[model samples]
Target: MATRATARPRSIDFNAAELMVKTIKGLTMDAVQKANSGHPGMPMGCADLATVLWTEFLVHDPSDPQWFDRDRFVLSAGHGSMLLYSLLHLTGYDLPMSELQNFRQWGSKTAGHPEYGHTPGVDVTTGPLGSGFAAGVGMALAERFLAARYNKPKHRIIDHMTFGVVSDGDLMEGIAAEAASLAGHLGLGKLIYLYDDNHISIDGATDISFGEDVAKRFEAYGWHVQRIDGHDHPSIREAIASARDDERRPSLICCRTTIAKGSPNKANTSASHGAPLGADEVAATKEAMGWPADPFHVPEDLRYALGEQMPEHAQNREDWDARLIAYREAHPELAAELALLIAGELPSQTFAGFDALLEGFEVGGAIASRKASHKILSKLAANHPTLLGGSADLAGSNGVLLPDTPGQSAAHPEGRNLHFGVREHGMAGVCNGMALHGGVRPFDATFLVFSDFMRGAVRLAALMNLPVVHVLTHDSFWLGEDGPTHQPIEHAMSLRLIPNLYVIRPGDAHETLGAWRLAMERKHGPTALLLTRQNLPTLAESRAEDVARGAYVLLDPAGEGDLDGIFIATGSELALAREAALRLAEQGERIRVVSMPCWEAFAEQDAAYRESVLPPSVGRERHLAVEAGSTLGWERYADHVHGIDHFGASAPAEVLAEKFGFTVEGVIERWAQIR
Candidate 1:
């Protein structure tokens, strides 16, 4: 203990960070050269910068990649994967050099680029140049929200920065610029970006296509910018240190460096950007860097020498754990909640609070499903420690604010509201990233029409099995004044196409809570909660917990009277379905009306459960499905689907609903056609 307290800074030459860069770069180059593939250039070029950031600057413990306080590192230039792989291997993570040797191989951890959740150290799945940067902004925003909530007088648990190493291609991307602009406006002081100004993209030198001043562009976004010699370890270190000194805006360290730093033949060439340097170039690179000729020869002395200089990350984690343990004893309840949430467990009171919410909604008068979604989400957000989320510049309209007490900001992790601004794409990606982070469950809201912009990220969420709840409001053409551009005619069907995604369009307010409950209960994959812009009646049959089972019979009128056909629907169309059911019942025809909120959730139900809800004996002849938008999947329920196939007309929602054949009269007409 005394030696730990006062000793020769633990047996390393440089810091652990520098060693990480070296090991990664060395192994990266060897693997690339061995396979006669891959671009070793970036790993070689930015090794030192990565070392400083990962070891000294990045507040991470490899053993706990999911640690909330850890800094997030996104290799936005994911093509330069060797850079990330090497770092993960050296940081005492589960990844080792043997795994690095399998780089770019089938089923290997070291893929072409950093893939989210696929690799332990990876934060977001990045292959697209600029999207990762936007994702980073989201991580920083989460940090801000958490910090605002948890960082009390002395227990600062959520304080962490988001530092990413982006290549020239990332900076040149318009999406990256868009994200940076919003990040600047939000005044995210904890976000720091390292711009690897190697000036080489696949086509050739950046001068061929991109020649603008990047620092000026970032400055235009209101970011504090710094230009530094990337290879100068001390200089880069100082720049990073100085950046955190600012407390208002995000900072960017634009580092000017060689693409392939040590590869003698290709060091500064565009050829070094993507393709692997050949045997001769690699050999020449090794010799030029004064490295020995032996293959995979990370000199024993060099290993010890490098190891001596690095920080002891394991020790750091131990200390942090000790501090957290102390925090636990001092603030038992908060600590328990923190521990549970950090362990990806919800608070004990979570389900109970949800129960209370649904009970209250049942007592309250009927309102729009969006209103119920708000009451459900905000109440649970305020009560459940793990429930956390916000909207994309639509918090006011979406009804997603955490009902934080008057004049009281969302000041704790238990608080659920988030303000994601207008960056829908970034908001979705961040929501996915937060789900990937695995402590607090997160959801983001935007108009369903903009789901087009968020579709890619929603797909990634499925790919990663991240359970991000997408609260898509204004689910159909009823989003009046915004016009066709804001109306989502095909968005629901389009989103439904993504495999493993649960798109739940609840019929009424109580069912809305049920959709939310299902979304939270689910751990396997993502759930998109599609809500209506128009007001929805709180149906007498709607029960939150029962509907949480996915699909349930709302009104089985055939048992009450006569038997004929079944009317099926979701969202606002449920009312039309009930009307249709009542009309058939009055006509002495038996009818069963069902509200199927989540297609995927219903699909997940057992065969017996399925048959029980949508019986095999039911009238396929007179079956009717009524919805306001594209009825792509409605064929499963009804032979005739009354939905908007084309863009909606320029008129009020009720008229548009009539035009789209969503009326009970239209439902009757369609039922008669199928009959």
Candidate 2:
């Protein structure tokens, strides 16, 4: 929340609003009918609210979906995706009628859920119950942060609003509660959510499971609350207008809408919530609403009216472009920085000077990998304006603080360090928002074990191919004193299972920095950096460049003879693997110690490179995978795996290591007889 500045009220003509609503409903009904599988109730119910927001309130240029200053509208109740698709089509986005006809079909952009990059106007991929609700908070925070950093007395280049239509299910989710609390605490005035208070869910009436007073709940979270008749255009406009006046809190307008606003039979029932309306019901509903019988048909006059609205939104973008040009002439350096940030580029020096930095970063030291990542962040934040993130209230423990910046809060909104409280699930969603917002590179940190709480958001990030970094520390049984409750036994292997998600368990300080570098550079998807809680000795042969290859030979067999076995490991276990290999060498066994830091990254390597690391001749039973985690996924890489498949005990690091058979001697003994 920055200073309160009342946004001028803008209204769509009543006739146009009514037509738009009718068109939206018609499209939603027909799309669901055509798809034979999708939700239509929400789209029909919230049509009026969405119509007002899009035509009157949302500051977007459909032609230029990536306009930096455009307002974002997220459908948090994403099962009602037809609502978004209909709106996108009506608003002149690249979504054509043909795509609408092929709704939910394979190879079509109009998927069951609104996917971020797949759809032209979708701000973020949001299908899970409260994901969009939480992510909207992140988008608002990003806007406030950029506005504070870039906006001057008269040039408000970064000012924008984040709007979302949340469903009953979204409000019921704990993630939304956590995010809403944070948004209110941070005073995110630009964040406004219109809660579609239609009292039906998959089961039945929400009263069956959800009976809490949602307006009061939001008010308790420090939000500006308003309740309105959802179908009443005047109330919808008035509530949104009132919401814009309050800049000290996020706003939630609870609109009491019917499940299917004007349906003849299924209007207020659960029947219309998910399944498509039959042809007879659709026709009857259309006749009742005074809509045409033809599927996907919108009135010509309504289409023309909607077309006219696009120029108003496009003009704002054109004006912003002109102002950007003038601002560049007046302040060249700031303009260039802004351009680089929006393009997701770092400063020229940081981008090109990484080789030199890595060479210096290869200094050997016995330090926790978390501290090494902290060191990398310190250097990156010093030069990269786009670097921004925070831990889940674990800055001291997880080491995610930027040394020079103040914490982001209600008062100091310009600070780069975000304080995400203790909400790991909420933090992941917010990080996704910051990444989706473009210009800010956001990372979230928490202990590796708590990643289970945040996995839903992490999976969505991977699905959308967002470049969010998750700094997970206290990686394994090495986390010790916190005991079994805090240790991560299967986090590395489990996280590696996520498609397109890069899971890197770096060996030491240098490899830790390499993981950070990889996370920063990989823009196509999210990255999880698994670091150590205990201090790890730096290897003499640790090469920063070798990390990019995912797994590299840390120590080769002493003799030129055939390799007897390969000891593959990651994180703290790599050190033990090396020691075990050395001990085996004394007994005439030639074992190769390979540091496999990132399984996902290594899998992407060419067959030649992969074969070189794990040669086929000395394969299968000869390969021993050593790590203090579940042995579930190691079968892909090793024949015999030495890993903890049971819960750990409460003890010191050394005791836990020996108890779990993770020590060098333990590994050597196990390797000697395993085959």
Candidate 3:
């Protein structure tokens, strides 16, 4: 372990703090002005609050940005990314003054939004309004869970807080409401959010669109709510101190502020919300705040003064290092486990006997893929203590319940099962946070149809390449009797459109096991396992290992003389295609069946492997695709698609299968047309 030099505690210097705030404002205005395409108002208005929080309450070592116990600060209102960028530069993170100068530029660390892996100190990607707020809740949840599980008496290794600066837009977003309710219910006392109540939006005053009593609303949500002047340094400090002391509930400090605090003409108006303050207003703002006129210039004395606490921050990390060393000596096993988790490494024995676990499923027995997933998840969770998750009020339907685990709540911080209620959007965001928090592997479940609500967070997860699992059950119209509202027609293909998201619709119990294993092994990006609500027979030929290839030949023509055509299918339709191939074989026609459970995974395979499965020798026109959902992207592989392009009606799965031409005869007819 590395240790930073110890230093004497610095006295509270309000004068230096005020100068730091002005410098933050100057950096914000200059960076936005240089970019000519960024938000400056929010950063300007919230500088005082951010300055106090970072310099005083935030516990982080700039030298060791990945310190496990460091406090996480999320700029949830990410449009004002300059606020975070300036802080990172001043506090001596890898971000430099040049990067701030290159704000929003190509290849710069300072992006239009705060990106997690892209920036050294940024904890999570934040751009979509309430996503950061919700993810912060997840970070807090992770902290509480890990602390409860690993912290010993006099050895508090995982103690930390998740803080954020949210905007009016974030509070107005429904996702934030869902997350806020859950946070309050869980009593995540370490989660704190400073609401930038500037009362302004791009459409002008926020009252025109959002007029609710925000403080009263949070109070109703069971948070420790407070109101304060955002620009008042003393009030900001006091409010944060009070929030830190509240151990029974999450805290929300509503900070009233002007849009562009020091700008003469643009202050308190919508004009400065997103656009740069222009050269004239920049100079005027600088003059108004008694700041230097030079762009991107921070007085050397002020910079040195602001960074005086760096030694203290580094020393805090060094102290934690000592405690961790002591903790390892006292509890070697737990310390080892914590080390693996913090390093995001899985045990070597995690999958040592993986094949034996799959042997329990009878080859020809009928079972829903979702139910099979439950069995696999139960086994995996038993072996992988860090693997924990829950469904969004659909645990029964989604089969996301971990056997023998208590539901997570205020009273049960060590519980592995998280109850996300009906908040699909919030659940996804929270899962992202848990993944970003680094000690836990987070997954969430919901109906395949409800994934639409989580698209924003899901997309961000893929963009950040976070290894989060999304278990989506009731995968298609086969989830019948619930009408079109409950059916997922285009969801699988739609999710596949996301660059790094793997959408796997397992065909049977064996394939479901493969999906779970793949999800756990994948270290980057996210995976969506689409399981069935209706039971289907486990194919005798299905192999769990082959599922990793994304697609494989399930059934070839019997005593093949010449290959006639290939039948491609996924999920439940694999059985239908196999039957169709067998039926065609009986009729003296040679047909091949291909099971493609995951398009993204298969696409990742080498061209030779993909070619071996699809066999370009068999022309595209000779390929007939079978699936129960929309057939939009199947054309890439098959010329004839036997699928339901329209929404399904309320009926039994069998009845809908017949109505939608999903029978063996239907596959034969569709293959005939293509041939």
Candidates 1 and 2 compared by lDDT, better number = 2
Off by over 4 Å in 1: 1-23, 33-37, 152-158, 290-297, 306-311, 351-366, 385-388, 405-417, 436-439, 559-565, 617-623, 635-639
Q: How close is candidate 1 to the true structure, as a TM-score?
A: 0.89
Which wins on lDDT, candidate 1 or candidate 3?
Answer: 3
Relative to the unseen true structure, what is the C-alpha lDDT of residue 342 in candidate 2, on a scale of 0 to 100? 91
lDDT of 1 by residue, 121-173 (tens): 78888877787887787677667665665556666556667788888888877
Clashes of each: 19, 1, 1
Local distance difference test, candidate 3: 0.89
Q: Flag the better candidate by TM-score, 1 or 3.
A: 3
Q: Relative to the unseen true structure, what is the C-alpha lDDT of residue 549 in candidate 1, on a scale of 0 to 100? A: 65
What C-alpha RMSD separates each model from the true structure?
A: 4.0, 1.9, 2.5
lDDT of 2 by residue, 1-675 (tens): 233235554555678778888888889899898889999999999999998888878888999999998998899999999999999998899999999999999999999999999999999888899999999999999998888887776666787789999999998888898899999889999899999999999889999999999889889989999999999988998899888888879999999999888899999999999998888999999999888898898778878888878778778799889878877887788889989889887677554555655565544558888987887878888878768899889998999889878988879988889888989999999888988898888999999999999999999999999899999999998888888899999888899889999999998887887887788888789999999888988888776777888999999976589988999988899888988898889989999999999888888899999999889998778999988899998999888898998887789999887777787889988897875
Clashing pairs in 2: 1-187
| Each prediction's TM-score versus the true structure | 0.89, 0.97, 0.97
Candidate 3 residue-wise lDDT, 498-587, digit = tens: 999999988999999998889888989999999999998988999888888999999998673768989898999999999989988888
User: What's the best-to-worst order under lDDT?
Assistant: 3, 2, 1
**Candidate 2 wrongly placed segments (more than 4 Å):** 1-11, 351-364
Could you tell me the lDDT of residue 300 within candidate 2? Answer: 81
